[model samples]
Target: MRVSVDTDRCCSSGQCVAAVPEVFDQDEDEGLVLLLDAEPPVQRQASVRLAAGICPGRAITIHEE
Candidate 1:
């Protein structure tokens, strides 16, 4: 799975970060979504999906490769 984040669409709600801190983060100054891992381990797929779903801004995109 590949994870991509559109920072421009991020609302900085931090839902993604809260859901999956290992995969996502927020810039302190801009409050934009920061993708820590574009390709996370298989074990982290669920959390990544959850984070993507919970993102109010729909900034997170997951692609299964």
Candidate 2:
């Protein structure tokens, strides 16, 4: 799976980071979403999907490429 995010739509809520620290993080100043790993390890798949689902703005997008 591949992960993508629209920065303009992100609110930096940190939900993604909280759910999947291995795949997501926040910027220091803007507190925006940042992908710590574009393609996270398999063990983190469920959390990554959960993060995408919990994003308030629907900014996170995932692809099975």
Best by TM-score, which number?
A: 1
lDDT of 2 by residue, 1-65 (tens): 99988888999899998999888889999999988888877898888999999999888898987
How many angstroms is residue 65 displaced in model 2 relative to the true structure, after the best TM-score fit? Answer: 2.7
- Using lDDT as the measure, which candidate wins? 1
lDDT of each: 0.93, 0.89
| Residue 57 lDDT (model 2) | 81
lDDT of 1: 0.93
How far residue 59's Cα lies from its native spot in candidate 1, in Å, is 0.1
The root-mean-square deviation over C-alpha atoms between each candidate and the true structure, in angstroms, is 0.5, 0.8
Residue 24 of model 1 has an lDDT of 91
Task: Output candidate 2 Cα RMSD.
Answer: 0.8
Q: Give the TM-score of candidate 1.
A: 0.96
Name the 10 consecutive residues with the lowest summed lDDT in model 1.
16-25
What is the clash count for each candidate, in the order shown? 0, 0
True-vs-predicted CA distance for residue 17, candidate 2, Å? 0.6
Clashing pairs in 2: none
